[model samples]
Target: MSARRPIPGLGAAPSTDLPVLLPFDRGKGRTPDIYLATRWLASLPPWTPLLILAVMLAWPLVAHAQGRYAYSDAFDALFRWMPFLVFEGFFFNILISFLAMAIGTVAGAALGLAQISLNPMLRRAAWFITQLFRNSPWLVLLFIVLLAFPFEIVIGGVIIPIPDWMKAVFGLSLPIMANISEVVRGAVQSVPTAQWEASESLAFTRRQTMWQIILPQCFKRMIPPWMNWYAILTMATPLCSLLGVEELITLSRQAMEGEDNHPELLVPFFGFALVIFFMYCYPIARATIWLERKYSVKL
Candidate 1:
């Protein structure tokens, strides 16, 4: 075998697979000055991207300080409280997202199926719901849920209070449900008409065919778009902060305004929040791409 050649920025290229995030042809006969940084960035290991981002952000501050103050009281305060607050806040963010996704998935699937119903009234009703939620501003939904929803339910003399967190989840889920309804409808309709006829010839009733023959196939087609929507919905979870939900962004602000927190630490604190979201959502995006490639429909 011939000796292996190395790629610039990246080490020797593997025979089996391309380097993560880097094109195989990245460094072939490249000019020295131009695109140098782009090649280097592409070649970097996954974790290093955030570190590089932090350094670039701090470059302005470092130049402004001119080495006079290597650090600040704000940064110190942020570090002191971050461990306790950031994780707690992030936990609630994830919790709210999980709850909203569960609710949206069930409701959206039903609405999607309803849109294709034989009954004209049901189809029209589903369409109306999808359009109403899809067009309404999420902030307006949040406010409506907050103000209009009853605070408690009384059943047979016992009163159960509705938590603000659940309200937030319902608010966020409204748009997600609408979008997911569209996803389901598109996926179901994408199946060949031949499949429906085949099922009918085999004595499959419409409902039976839908559940047994149609929805099963729709799963693979729906997954990629479903994951994509999940990512979008997760990113939108921060909007819960507007309703006093105490999620990541809300806690970040609280940390910034705390008596011990330094105003100067604002950048680092906000930067940390940004990184947290990136870390959470990046894997989801990657998985979505992988699933799309794996389960892509031939048609």
Candidate 2:
């Protein structure tokens, strides 16, 4: 067979064998893939909270039937201390989450940007730091932070006592920072490489391209994961109780002890903690899913 030649002033016939690209096959899709656990949480039924509440209510009755204590007594005690648990203990947990998230987000954003820096040393260092804390157990990080930090600092004839809760905040922030760094780096990289090429053609510097072009596009993509992490961080605040940070779980323990260490109080106090945490985090979970769907890249 003879080879065919191109026509003058005309391109060769367009190829008809182009590959089909399905949405799922695309690098970017309308529905981003979230963690399986997070997807499961977001898929929980609306009755979940009601069912938990019902179980909590029935717990007292079950305790009473077993002759552990009076049913009304446990309920009454839970109600009596509900304000303390919610206002003080749970609120403290929220404070820690907020502080940790703020600190982590700032540091993580910097680290994430550094991970993509042109400087090889800076990129490797950022990656090392991110992976180190990201893989470490949260409780171990908490303990390490607690032990490594001093209880107080003295400077110029002044003593500033560092509270355990502050240490907890710092501890909790380390892992969050690592995770957020990954989130940021992933979001930035997810942007089409064409953006970088386009920016380069426009005479934009790396810093200008990142700040003005890349990051703005990434902000929305980063938000859902950021909020997801915040919800996870809030739930993790209970771990601070082990460090004597006086969060919801710790105060629940104290409340039980104050109630004469009654075995029956266990169900009411701890059950309420479970319910409250669910109520708080479920909304966040739902919001995360919604935002993920909303901001997902449509390719």
Highest lDDT, which number?
2
Evaluate candidate 2 by giving its C-alpha RMSD to the native, one decimal: 8.3
| Model 2 / residue 147 / CA error / Å | 0.5
Clash pairs, candidate 2, are none
lDDT of every model, 2 decimals: 0.79, 0.89
lDDT of 2 by residue, 84-157 (tens): 99999999999999999999999999999999999999999999999999989999999999999999999988
**Candidate 2 — what's its lDDT?**
0.89
* Candidate RMSDs in order: 12.6, 8.3
lDDT of 1 at 256: 73
Using Cα atoms with residue i matched to residue i, what is each candidate's TM-score against the true structure? 0.78, 0.86
The parts of candidate 2 lying over 4 Å away from their true place are 1-34, 60-68, 297-299
Q: Residues 239-281, candidate 1, lDDT per residue (tens digit)?
A: 9899998888888888877734544556777777777777777
Give candidate 1's error at residue 164 in angstroms: 1.6
